[model samples]
Target chain A: MLKKERQALIIKQINLHNKVLSSDLSLTLNVSEDTVRRDLHELAQENKIIKVHGGALSKSYNVTSQQSDTYAYEEKNIIALKTISLIKEGMTILTSGGTTMRAIARALPSNLKATFITMSPLIALELIEHPNLEVILLGGKLSNDSKISVGGEVVNRINEIKADLCILGINGLDFDGITDSDWEIVQVKKAIINASRVVIASTISEKLNSALRLKVCNLKEVDYLITELPSDSPTLLAFKEKVNHIL
Target chain B: MLKKERQALIIKQINLHNKVLSSDLSLTLNVSEDTVRRDLHELAQENKIIKVHGGALSKSYNVTSQQSDTYAYEEKNIIALKTISLIKEGMTILTSGGTTMRAIARALPSNLKATFITMSPLIALELIEHPNLEVILLGGKLSNDSKISVGGEVVNRINEIKADLCILGINGLDFDGITDSDWEIVQVKKAIINASRVVIASTISEKLNSALRLKVCNLKEVDYLITELPSDSPTLLAFKEKVNHIL
Candidate 1:
């Protein structure tokens, strides 16, 4: 593989697992240990990752304030700004957690007044910064990997609320459905979709056509799809027919 | 007042109100605005506060990661270590949010197995670092100042669960009761006290014998009082008769 392609894959691995072992990367990439070490060191020096004794940790995973160092932060921030245009005054919005959602919360206009219901504590913390916004945190057993509330309690709470909009920061978006690896989080995401009148899927362009272990919902269920790229970009052309609107 | 005394009071004021303007501090302290500005600048230089254009913010109130710059961090950490001795294996621990509780969560042993229920999203994020701990975040409307879920929903959730131990990072503890400034948070703390089998109040020595506007519970309700001071310290003598133990 090309060096750029190999480094991108390593970053993807770190983003997925929050932490990656150099030994495991060496085995998976079929590269020597020295090559893996060099890649990790280069990434660390670039402020992309925090190199540890045995491996490296994603910057966003450890520090919530260090969004500048997050993988694809610029693209995610673009998605955040685009997502803001959909929000209206006095609307009740439900949200699932991820770096994309965090960016959205940070980018919200200070004058906008809305009610936000989220399963992620980090997002809830960020949303409360807006004086005009009301933030409701869905309480339940928190998933360590996802850093959001999950389990049956969260779904039960979602069932009782009728929100005007739902924003999902999904892992994968394929022709069939929105898929994620964790079953509990997927369950919460599914409930969120059912509870809202309109559902918007916000992701980066790279997540297009990707599928994970578990399916969350079908592409038809999403009313809007927002990505970093322009609506007329060739990368999003195929998904135009799948959703009601592409932004 | 002595410069040391004035600076100490300034830190106390910052802790009470997350953000304080130099003009307000000058009026409250009966000092010139220039003196207040100089004090804020010195505190900012020591990394004790984050000075802004017209005022300053408590280090712990904004960036959760910058705990080292938190006021009396060493004292709070010492209390955290002592509080750990009270926990046993497989206990269900309920926590309130504050720098003191955050210290305790960070100090928890990795091998210890326990379940933690908390209203603060920040504490939940900190507690999840322990692999063996189960973290349940009570969902409700989040308080912007406290950064914890508050309201009827949170109190109802606390009513359902019977926690083995409740750890309260109280603002004030006096002969009358455990007190705080916010009415909504005091209600939630009162509920937590009634829902737990034993209540533990963790606070710094400075807060001892201080009383705020709202009362959470009576002194007799607390099972233990843990502070940075030794149990036999003269500062704790007044509180010795009110609680079962003081550490």
Candidate 2:
């Protein structure tokens, strides 16, 4: 195959599979791993894909480029559907910023009357058309990559509100606790933990064993942990043992 | 000339001059304004340039884009240099998010002692290595376009602190007041205005006489308005008349 054709094939594979290992692509394309790596680097430079630790992932899968709402659509939809089960009319809720939270915002039924206090611009935009829902955006310094607010101001504002429920989108969670990738994010999460009456974490199964740089709260702080997979999964069981509840 | 060459030439002209009139481009190119408009439209489609009310402006000149820091480097440097002059040792200062502010953050003297509070992740990242600076990042919803935090939580945090100075980057300013293009941004700016003892606005001359969707604070609320040009400039004079001070 021509060099352009092979590169195009690699891109197609990444788009199809969400991620591709360099070695795998090398073998598939009948090229050396070094050549595949070079192609991936060039493609990444073109913003066609993202170079991960050992491979390439579709840039579209990353939430920072576009609105976070566009990523993990199915997972977010399932998480949102599961999350809405915990909501009740007239309840005041605090939702954090993430693709999952954005999905929940979009999936919220218009008939469900509730007050939402959020630190996500995408959420505010999503909730703008909802007449029955009152959305209060927590203002602070913006993080361009995450499209979420983080800083002391966001934390202080979260502290002032007493929410019936807080639906947190976990960056990473292990048996020990909920963790965040950024130190600034931890500050906001800490405030959310202090203000909410019931803390609910909406995360995917993949994030169970992962831990990031900052620790927000212990698993004990979470009232419930919801994931798309079945409740009997080992990760869920481990989390259930540490936290108060699981969904 | 070929269509692509003509389009490239127009784009080059706009980048070279900063602004160009459609009629002038038409006359210079010996083509009708309608053809120039079509070429501009095509270039805009390819993200080569942006179509303004009258003619095209170089996308390279857009300060909000990912590579915006590269363009307008001289103007941003001057603004940063002037802005840093306002900072003093041990004073707590609030800075809004923008390429201009980011430049200011970069230009800050490493030995200067101050508590720098902001919602811009880029600024926070830049300040991490500053030994003498205490960086407090305000948390809230993040806006991807501007990479600034906004919303209630961020606002509440701002209200809790009384900063010595607040340095703001104006989106659009008019005879009436300072306006933001986004609704949530207005809330964030209002919080910033209320939290600081002195409000300083840093903007270019062209930003004046324009209004955006969200109103932050009126010119009267500002303690000082700083621009690149002298205070006697027509736009600055208009702004100076509405406010108590100019820098």
| Best by the DockQ measure | 1
Q: Which candidate has the highest lDDT of all?
A: 1
All models, DockQ values? 0.34, 0.10
Residue B84 error for model 2, in Å? 2.6
Clashes of 2: 29
For model 1 chain B, give the 10-residue run with minimal summed lDDT: B61-70
Candidate 2, residues B54-94, lDDT tens digits: the string is 77665544232143454466677777888888899999998
Error of 1 at B103 (Å): 0.4
**Model 2 bad stretches (over 4 Å):** A1-92, A95-160, A169-198, A202-223, A227-247, B1-51, B54-74, B97-99, B106-112, B118-132, B136-162, B171-199, B209-225, B229-247
Off by over 4 Å in 1: A1-69, B1-69
Q: Candidate 1: lDDT over CA atoms? A: 0.88
